[model samples]
Target: MSNFSNVSRRRFVKLAAASSGAVLLKGCLGNPPDTTATTAATVGSAALPAANVGTGETPEVTTIKLGFIPIVESAPLVIAKEKGFFDRYGMTGVEVSKQANWASARDNVVIGSAGGGIDGGQWQMPMPHLITEGIITNGNKVPMYVLAQLNTQGNGIAISGMNRQKGMGLKINDPEYVKGFERNQGRKFKAAHTFPNVNQDFWIRYWFASSGVDPDSDIDLLAVPPAETVQGMRTGTMDAFSTGDPWPYRIVADDIGFMSILTHQMWKFHPEEYLALRADWVDQNPKATKALLKAVMEAQQWCDDPANRQELVQICSGRNYFNVPSEVLTAPYEGKYALGDGKPEVNDFKAGPLYWKDDIGSVSYPYKSHDLWFLTETMRWNFHNGAIQDFDMARNLIDRVNREDLWLEAAKEAGFAAADIPTSTSRGIETFFDGVTFDPENPEAYLASLKIKRA
Candidate 1:
């Protein structure tokens, strides 16, 4: 949290309220209706008519049994309900389920029956895509699609409190970052990330690569779940870890670790995770899927509202969920962060909803370059074969997997800027990495051109 900028002016008043011992909550967090004044521009109801949605006429998926793990990344799901987004979109009989873990959630979706217990649920951003490619699971790779990208960025590379006091602290991207480790070289820093090939792993790898350190060789990656990361640090099992939402911030505050590198800075607007469903769910229950999408999108819109941030924190701390004081979750959501080395500053947190969309139908779906970069990484790590057997069809298969067009159509129905939404989204096109630009469309050529590669 050392360097922070570009925070909106609205952040100031919220910070003031927080300091007075008032825990803020947006939408349901006691935030005035006026707080929404700033958010009015973005909230859009769907073009579909939820108005006529009666249990009889509404699509059968009306009972959306959504599954979720109890962690901070699940905000959009919770916000969708609390903020009344689902209601606005005509998705009335929706339920937020508690999942055992990522595997169980995925299994339920794959099983598709009573075991499934639901139509669609939240998933890791890249997971749905990877699963369909036969990377994370072994099955027919059902037609799953993302309705939206939930939260953009909210994590950091953190050290145990023991290490926080080792030096004044570490500033990422600065020459002195790896220097403080001279004495602790042999002492391995146990780092935790959620799952393999997901954003957590991707961002952590990006951070290590940006710092000229090979993540695989330089760090110990423990397959620890997000909920357990805090205790792992408190004890001695994990020395350092990269996780999203409440985990890192909760640990840092308990003196378990000092914030080291922000994942947000390493890759601003890096896709964090998403709320996804089986494509059939969308097709079979078009009305339900759209309603759920609208609700989740509204929740995101609500989360972005600074005025209601404190309230969002309290809900995140519910007994069944994060279960921490509102302060811990509340502060970071508003961009407040500390290095835990006796220094403090405002953090620029990234939050967006590009994760859930139906872009593949539109030209926007096949950001071929974006797919190329992911494919390149998959190949480098032995995840996917380097070749798309049928270059065009593989490209088409990859393109068919996303649903950006659904997002635009829904937005348009809800009275939004339709043309403004592009036909394609390219992770490679933006070239947002630290001082480096990457074009995913031609990943193979880019890989060949790179001066750096595994020996």
Candidate 2:
């Protein structure tokens, strides 16, 4: 139904190359090639007994293959499995598949689980929208639904140790400091994100542009796997990288780099990654969709509990999950960071990754306004080359893909307090660290206020 058979010969070739790149990415990360994604649920105990849960309606399907990368954004999925949240909801067969890389995740989602790919799981902003519109799916429109945001404020921009004294913390401070990379160093400021034209890329681009440095022209910004990024930073081949937690902390721990800024400091409570799935699957199994949401929502609340921080860290750091030391995942949970290069240490619990709620409101709710901003930012950078024509088109796409209604249904059914459920789809205006405000109601004004953007 999604027309996978008609992909042009050229686009097919690109997909093949991307598949090869995924294998290369896994090797770069020192992970053995997983011909099939390993099942995360297999490492955890079976579902909780029904007595612990209010037996809601049974789901149409008990199993679904969901994919995730090793990042803080993926904690909810792992927790849902390891903590028996999925089992409590009668969704015992949910498989948390570890993706090789973002590109592989994208390609896998296009194929779907029946074809030996993922149905969907944790995804970066605009990815669900992009996949639905066929902009990034090799021209095959694989409609996706943005179910709920996984977490917020776990992302950071890492500056290689070589530029520790270049005044690159939080803000550029001086445009020439970054612009002089080619003159001072022998090359342009080489930077990368785990994926191109997404949340991580946007964070770094916003930080550079806020200080009057052009992201595209003033630096060489591209996509590189997280492990490759760290290695590049160590060898002085890469100047900076934008990615989610664990890597930012790893950079500091390995003495390869210092965090220029955590995303929490850039835009507090900013929307991060999300849980999405193939729209076809969701459509065919509505009860199962809500069941999945219920499980993840419960897990989010569990993840946010300070008392569960230690167990949460232990579960996420296991070999089947992030595969990093527990300490690498601990500080972000406690909101503690060394923040190398003489910068002051970060020591506030509110600064780390948040799942269920934040200082503002429900982090788990998939706000339509937040989706609009991601689309707007993608358009501002002219990502996908005019695929998103205008704000009106973006709003329409959000209407189709953002399943906030399903999230509300699941929350209410799961016995969430009325205060916890967001009353409105819009979170009002969002303000960034550089004093920029994004009024969701008026995206044109927000775009016009930007000094640097292709739009």
> Which candidate tops TM-score?
2
lDDT of each: 0.56, 0.83
* Cα TM-score of candidate 1: 0.75
Relative to the true structure, candidate 2 reaches a TM of: 0.88
Summarize candidate 2's per-residue lDDT along 1-455 as a digit string, tens digits: 11111222234334333323211100000111232342222111322112223435889999999999988899989988887777767899999999999999999999999999999999999899999989998799999999999999988899999888878887877779779889988899899998888899999999999989999899899898888888999999998999888887888998999998999999999999999999999999999998899888778876777767888899999999999999998998999988898899999998999998888988999888899899999989999997899877887788788887777666655545555776667788999998999988788889999999999
List candidate 1 segments past 4 Å from native: 1-60, 165-188, 342-344, 347-375, 384-394, 418-420, 449-455
Q: Write the per-residue lDDT of candidate 1 for residues 369-437, one digit (tens) a residue.
A: 444445455444443444233334334544555654455444443432333243334433444445655
TM-score of each: 0.75, 0.88
Instruction: List residue ranges in candidate 2 displaced over 4 A.
Output: 1-56
Prediction 2 global C-alpha lDDT: 0.83
